[model samples]
Target: MSFIIDDTDIPEDDVILFSILYSCVTVVFAMAVLSKFLTNEFRFGFRSALSLAVLFLGEPLCQFFVKGPIGVVCFAVGCLLVYSILPASHLPVGNKAVLITGCDSGFGNALVAKLDSIGMQVFAGCLDKDGPGAVSLRHSCSDRVHLLQLDVTKDEDIQAAVSIVQAHVGSEGLWGLVSNAGVCYIGELEMISEWITRKVMDINLFGAIKVTKSFLPLMRPAKGRIIIVSSVLGRISFEGYGIYGISKHGLIAYADTLRQEMRKWDIKVSLIEPTGYATENTSDSSMRLKREEIWDTMDEQTKATYGREYLDEIYNNLLGIFKMLPDDLTPVIRAMRSGLLSKRPRERYPCGAGADFVTYIFGLLPIWISDKVTMSMSAMPKTAKPRIQMIQ
Candidate 1:
């Protein structure tokens, strides 16, 4: 027997089903285009989900707020907003000018190479003229890479960079700013020196803001983008990373606020949060251990009271985990490019497998639950006292 349906007798359920299907397809299509430009899956996943949620719920909610054409208008506007914010597939490419800070190593170096490889003009900011990053980029990309001596924490460097951009690209030419330069100091919260804490905040948080503020005026007219390189630590805290975590936490707030404030100007503010990546910093485990040695010496009494055996075990555990984690910087480079080039760029991107999963789980949990989990996972039991104490 053949099934037949009268076109005029279609059920309301069918209509709703069709609408929902169409809506979902549209959202997914938009997200796919966005994912290409976004290098970090974490950022793309969170932002796309949020926008889709709003779009899916918006029209139905409008039905309650208003009736007929007015409600329809509101729904249409909401849809447009969502689409407008999604990254576009056909974003302009080639010869685009970009300024990246902290190109001395790691993400900055990787970004510089990636952008230059794709034929974009890269202006890299290094902490020193003779820094290894500048030397390497200059050796490889040569003319495509312009290494500027920049200390993000210094006002002189910020002003100089602004002038350099205006001169190189003029007002209409510069396209993006990648604020990737930052520092990290890991240790017990109470044991970390006040000087170190302030220094970490200065570079990771304040430096990013300084660079953005200095260049924002130039970007204001052209709707240029700013990509802030944060860390997974910003979203989730861990043992021995208190100061670094504090810096990242500040960035989370800064990036969010900047995103809202810049909406009117059409200047997009995106943040890249990457977990442990193989960079010069992570590779130099010996240097980190040496720093710990100095701290250990300085706080010998505290170390003795706390029990050296326990501290040693904690240190070893941290080192082993760091060694096991992947050190690839490619993901960070991808995320940075996506933030700069995506048609509907996300506000935040989390890089690395561990970073993605951990941030997602932590973000979903209640504050209290997350805190308990972190504490439990990071805690170490006390150990017996050292057999002998050395006086330095």
Candidate 2:
């Protein structure tokens, strides 16, 4: 029943031993958590890990290691615990404003509604301001949501948007810029022509770059956030998505460079890399049409070599992958929200079912091994016979 401990009853050696054991256990667990979360989730590479090691262990080595363990444990645990909680506690929305591109549909359209509901001023940049998605947002959202016609690939459109956004925001500046406009192209590498590749790149990679550059002036003063909606394909490429994967991969490179450069201004850049999801572009009918268009563009020799059935098999393989995808966009929406509002936003968010596991395994594995694994999982089914035959 006594609340006090008797120092006389316990030996001094036992107290030292107990403290050492406790510190050892705490340090091991802390290291594991930091390695898993920092390397995989935050995408912090080797340099950051080395710097963190110095930070966590520096004090522990000082003062002949006495009182060092307690200090290290307290610092690591306290800082990480607070860091975990900070992301969930969003910043005050207040009168802050955000502009989301590709608002005509999908993630951009959904994010517009979500941010607007939370009281942030929203500029919904639609490819067509009169389009159904834009009209729906106009009718559904509050007076604070403004709709602008923003086609990212067009220099004129991007410039006009800058002018419009600047006129409205004045000196307060834009709080966030979501470069969500993108197009997908799924076909064999040979089937995808230079023209097709260029078209996809125009919207997915170059468009995003141009839009971000134009808005940097507006965002620089506010030290705003930049969220790029990339794809899981950015980390790992598949057999049929050559063009799409290339564009997304380019985005990964651009975001990395931009993140480091923006640090001086305190602007944060984040990427949302989602796996397969049921969206308008990924619908069965739309994909079918795209397949047909690609097929039509091929020459006689090309068609004969790859064959109709072989091409059909590619489409079938994509549908099989889609079957496993979640139709719910909630995960992606939450990631976008975190990227915009979190106190400590992740560098890259792998969103969707098994996205983290999939990206990690395939992204880090040797290319040969990853290719074999990818083929085993979702490669195109073989045709009955080889398509090559004597032309004569």
Candidate 3:
């Protein structure tokens, strides 16, 4: 049937065409502006930029040019092309294998299930094989998912994992290695002791390196992908995220170098940065309690030097992340899969709501300006509480 129209009104075809054209142009323009920032943040080069442009604008572009019933057909075809252009690794599900660390909870746990569902052989490296998440994951997948006890920092655990993965893949070599284990605790430079500092670095920085190194040989022949899970804080650092920021900064640097070096070996490397997505104990209340715990550890003199109010302020600021972050981590999982499977994956994927803002805009900003802006939101957690009585 034809698109019949009243004499008083514009033709329906014209209206439809205008709407589709306007929508496509508007969305593409907005995404173009976003590209300026995302490109810097994630190093989203030409390929990624083009892929995303098509993915975001294809349907409207298709619908506008192809009329009526034909438009619907064209829209589907455009969407398929857009999806196909994006970096996505495709292999027989059960044929490929990936080992992911920190599979006990959060992104790691979620990704393990996602990969397993699609048919990949998943070696889920949980900190505790007997943990609730591991047990749950095991129950869900009887085969193709193996849960191994892993502590990224420990030598023995790494060796055992290498042995396990080698046994499964044989001459084929492992297809992917994901460094997803990390920890975060908030405190000032001096407030945290050398021991705590070392622990954080050992797990978040050194541990990932250890895992990657151990599995490199297996991946070499297989020409696999190394996926590093980093935080937005890797680029943007501030008060409460001091040590964690240091570790992430180091991690990103390490991953960047690895990506460049691995290129010659035909092995891919990608970094996935997510904003304040909920991890097992990363809730606002849990972090507040953690801050309280850290406060309790301070020596009396130290406590007196930095009052409880100061720590409270820091924790309160930390909670600001919860407001911006989404609980669901599907974007992160998709990124992981793309890096793992896609023949030409991105060097970095910044997923989640504020990931780009934190990495690109905030990271690129002048420190003084950022400091001023952040401080206005809440006073920098003071080294010492003001002595109001002295003023009186």
Candidate 4:
């Protein structure tokens, strides 16, 4: 085949290079299309895969063969193809009902506004009814948005929420349940006591499970979705983030198990594993003070082994991660929106650019390499060897 574009400024060698690179890109894109389809059981239809493949291959192929500028035409065609097959979530979802926990702030609050803007009935679950986020949502959203007090850790609060949601959803049934309420704590495992461990796990993991269980009856009727907000730490663990990571890790397992069991009712379960974003959980002041408090609780033997200097360095490193977190929470909100509104939802939605790589790719590497790479992010304190001269 003649692979050259006529009347082009492109050189022959450059064409060869572009062709090779474009081929690789095309293959990868095709693989993604195949993988997404097989895993989702062709949820979007064959056209969805075709549309995506065309979007990836068309533009590049046009540039290589037809004309470099023809790539623009391919992009336009690809967009239209995708639009035709895209689900209803792209537009307003009216009449459908969704309940979001932790609407007091962060992704949950933003999602309430987004869904409300689209004319969907939103139930905003807040731990603090009078808190700033709930107040803002109540004022901004339409009458369809209802604010309900919910504490995921408490059975009474969860049961109360269930009743409120049932009353609201009624015959229509709840279309979505978003488990976004959770807490984060930073410290080594040794420093974090059994109480702290239970506290973190209870809220982050058990709390999500509690909310989901309460709403399952409603969701089962509508074949609705359950979207859990997890962290990238759920996919990759680090040194100081032990407690937080454990909770998220447990959440992932629960979500995965629920996804299978719920298949009988066609209820969708999706985990939004997002890169850290700027939220109350990632607040600089709260985390720094938290580290100090956790350090004070450590036993003398543990403190001596790790030393205060190590804690200081770790505290500083934690600050860096929080600072680097993106201010926007849109990616996570969008993922939940997709799960709630789409015909076929992915099992796992990793938010942000390189998330899939870390979640899927990096996880496949050798354990030693992965461990070294994670630990190398910051140094761990070294313990001194015990003297043998006394025994001799």
Number of the top candidate by TM-score? Answer: 2
lDDT of each: 0.74, 0.80, 0.77, 0.77
Worst window of 10 by summed lDDT in candidate 4: 383-392
**TM-score to native of every candidate shown:** 0.74, 0.79, 0.74, 0.76
Across 99-199, the per-residue lDDT of candidate 2 in tens digits comes to 99999888899999999888999999999999999999989999989999999989999999899999989998999999999888787788776777888
Question: Which lDDT value does model 3 have at 177?
Answer: 92
lDDT tens digits, residues 42-118, model 3?
A: 33544456556665665555444544545555655554554454444354455789999999889999998888888
Give per-residue lDDT, candidate 2, residue 392.
82
| Candidate 4, pairs of clashing residues | none
Error of 3 at 389 (Å): 13
On a 0 to 100 scale, what is the lDDT of residue 286 in model 4?
75
Q: Best-fitting candidate, measured by lDDT?
A: 2
Q: What clash pairs does model 2 have?
A: none
Error of 2 at 301 (Å): 2.3
Give Cα distance to truth, residue 35, candidate 1, Å.
11
Candidate 1 residue lDDT tens string, 32-74: 5457446443344544676767656775665444434455566
